[model samples]
Target: MAENDSFHHVLRGLGPQVEHRGEVIVIGLGRFGSSLGRTLVDMGHEVLGLDLDEQRVAEHSDSLTHVAEVDTTNVKALRQLGVGDATTVVVCIGADVESSVLTTAAVADLEVPNIWAKAMTEPHGRILARVGAHNVVFPEAEMGSRVAHLVTGGLLEYVALDDDFALVEMVAPDAIVGVPLGESNLRADHRVTIVCVKPSESGFTYADRDTVLDPSDIVVVAGHRSDLERFADR
Candidate 1:
């Protein structure tokens, strides 16, 4: 796997970086919300988990910095819980579109510095954005797209920088093996740039124009998604 991919996997397994530790309030204790709260707490941040379900609140109480059973859609109830004071708020009521929108609006009304929400669809995401969510996540859709890329790209790992650009790791193609990068003219031919090369038996190294690629070498490239796909096809 690529270094970036490994880094992301580590974050999922443990938590985010601790550099921005602060008070975070996560409303709705569903799987995604609970996971976010737990990860935040594990990263040394103070995470407060809120949910309408008493059982869910109870289940995450020990893992989080704080847990409360509250109606997130109620502005008065949110105010009483000091929701406005949170540095960051994550609304995770994705299953219920109404609740998600209402909760996001309420948090935004509180003037929280950062608000992240989960949406089930594009329209839902747009609604959340219009209501004041700083970031909207579509877990299922994003995962499905990632799986599709993995299955079709024949790549060791892939990370999208944006809709058009991506970083990908793959084995050196037979046509490129034993050839110097300068002579290959990969950038001119495929519109992709080799960022790094990881030898099967050793660590990673920067790819220079004169670097010779071997069949066993794994190369990390960056370029537009279409360009990378074309390059990988070879």
Candidate 2:
């Protein structure tokens, strides 16, 4: 696999698993939307992708379960495309704030059980939320933060759980290398908990207090954002 695909695979593995197997409708076939649809399909879920741009629709036709060129802002178009039947609808028209908002509103009016939208800015996210989006994502900002964490050196990956908490994958700190987790006192000292450890060899295992940290091991840690930053800096 390509490096980007490998990275995405690792990231997905680190996230919580979903048990639901249902149809998903993704509106706006941009990079984010297309990736989401493809991932959902890879996870054994049926996906319907829609976009205003015929070129975009054509590009993903072979990859997605279904693809259609339709204006998501039109309630009639969405209904005709069976958007109301989807288990979830994701609006991912980040470049066009107007279209994104309108599409989200249209989906909301349909009262889809799950509605997710991507916003380009804080105000755009607020607008999407106001329009009844169950979740709003600021992809650019989130990516920037992830990159910043990696640039700090020991951190391999970072995922924000919320404004205050984060989950980070990083190399075992030198101070804790070769020490039993119980003796490391990371939780008491740094207010962080090691949830999983990935050895240099292969798969990850749940971390236990008796688990010994190898110098080459990568550990997934969860804690408040500030505490995580401090732990990483150490």
Candidate 3:
């Protein structure tokens, strides 16, 4: 790369040697990037969005703290755009695996402390990890699995803490309705713990052993995925 690499960009000055406390740089202003940048912006964090497409830069310019058109695969371009000073950088290039991997490699070369990359497949995730992406996310796969669980189980909300463990929100089942939770022996009988419960008329409160559940009430349960499924079914 030379001084005149032809990938001109309009970038905001990072100012001095200090990295902003709550700022993030997002590469590839596609759907994921736009959503993430806007979310960060909404959360009161300054987000810089970078992309190769001028249209993408223009479209997200008003939404993020700053938007720029730059070839992120070029390490020099990223450094010149002040990406090296970012505390966190995320590569959200979804379709083009080659560009995604190369961009991740470039960000790694910058030695940014935190690096996150989106991957379309397991192999892509492995490649990103090998190239120094500290966190590799399979968003589509995770979302699909979550939706599948929601569809199959009669759950109001299902959040997977990890591969095997999960937290779920569901209506109080007949098995536990009318029985005091402590005496119900749910933890011993079903292997699920009721963390909290919400009656129809009030907001949620912590569940204790003496808490008696009522029908039509909602409960938050934490347990292994398999146990949660069985408990939810009952």
TM-score for each predicted model, relative to the true structure: 0.81, 0.87, 0.87
Candidate 1 vs candidate 3: which has greater TM-score?
3
| Model number with the top lDDT | 3
| Residue range 1-234, candidate 1, lDDT tens digits | 875554333223222323333688999999999988889888888988999999999999899999999999998899999998777788989889999999999998998877778888877876887788877777887778777887997788888766678889999987678989989988888899899999889999999978998899999999999988888889
User: Model 1, stretches more than 4 Å misplaced?
Assistant: 1-21, 202-205
Poorly placed runs, candidate 2 (over 4 Å): 1-21
lDDT of 1: 0.84
- Between 1 and 2, whose TM-score is larger? 2
User: How many clashes in candidate 3?
Assistant: 0
Report how far residue 20 has shifted in candidate 1, in Å: 5.5
**Model 2 reaches what TM-score against the true structure?**
0.87
Model 3 C-alpha lDDT versus the unseen true structure:
0.86
Ranking of predictions according to lDDT: 3, 1, 2
Can you rank all candidates by TM-score, best first?
A: 3, 2, 1
List of clashing residue pairs for candidate 3 = none
Residue 125 error, candidate 3, Å? 0.6
